[model samples]
Target: MTQQTENRTPERGTHVYDPATCRVGEFQGKVGPHAMLRPVGGGREWQADPGKIRRATAPERLRAGVKAANERAGRML
Candidate 1:
């Protein structure tokens, strides 16, 4: 994981993740220890963990979640 720097700003086209609400958004800027962005709401801003945002939106995590759910249902190989 990349250590966040005090001077580092959110990448222009990067995505933001909000663990509090389990939501993702286009990167805007830093709003404290988290990334800020406007999500589904009309021009509303939210903060999220940068690393978690990436992981939460990653295809692998999605696949893992699906696999886990399937396993819980006794559908895994």
Candidate 2:
């Protein structure tokens, strides 16, 4: 991990992108060496290396939010 990766740990509640999973999630906390992340609208959390994640971009966040809303709407029928 580079210095940036080694030193960066997103604050809790921040949105980050996990390249390994190609998904955006809210940073929950750390577990061992992995950062725990949850889906934007709330769902099961997954572990991702802190060294491999970056903050989510605006477009990414928008997409995730829309997807979550759609999912919820689908389930409401």
Candidate 3:
């Protein structure tokens, strides 16, 4: 017999996609440093320097995921 299952792991400090602004909001819900929102175009982006997001354990991976999602959605990110 063959079985298939989906992985439902909760991404930590991952970028959340917002269709309205065509940008990805990172470090959602938390403020002060680390909080960032990057637009998905024009090579322009926003990022927090001294926030938890900066210190996030998975910053690189999260950013990559965000970028991929943005591209898939045809946004800048």
TM-score of each: 0.43, 0.92, 0.24
Query: Considering lDDT, which of the candidate structures 2 and 3 is the better prediction for this target?
Result: 2
CA lDDT of each candidate? 0.55, 0.89, 0.41
Runs in model 1 deviating more than 4 A are 1-10, 40-42, 55-77
Off by over 4 Å in 3: 1-57, 75-77
Candidate 3 per-residue lDDT over residues 13-69, each given as its tens digit? 454443334344443332443334554332445544321222223554467567667
lDDT of 3 at 77: 33
Taking the tens digit of each residue's C-alpha lDDT, what string does model 1 give over 1-77?
A: 34333445567655445566766556776666767766532247766665445523475345545654666678434
- Model 1, residue pairs in steric clash: none
TM-score of 2: 0.92
Q: Which one is best on TM-score?
A: 2
TM-score of 3: 0.24
How far out, in Å, is residue 38 in model 1? 1.3
Sum up the clashes in candidate 3: 6
Report the lDDT of model 2 for residue 69.
100
Ranking according to lDDT, highest score first? 2, 1, 3
- Our model 2 lands, by Cα RMSD against the true structure, at 2.5
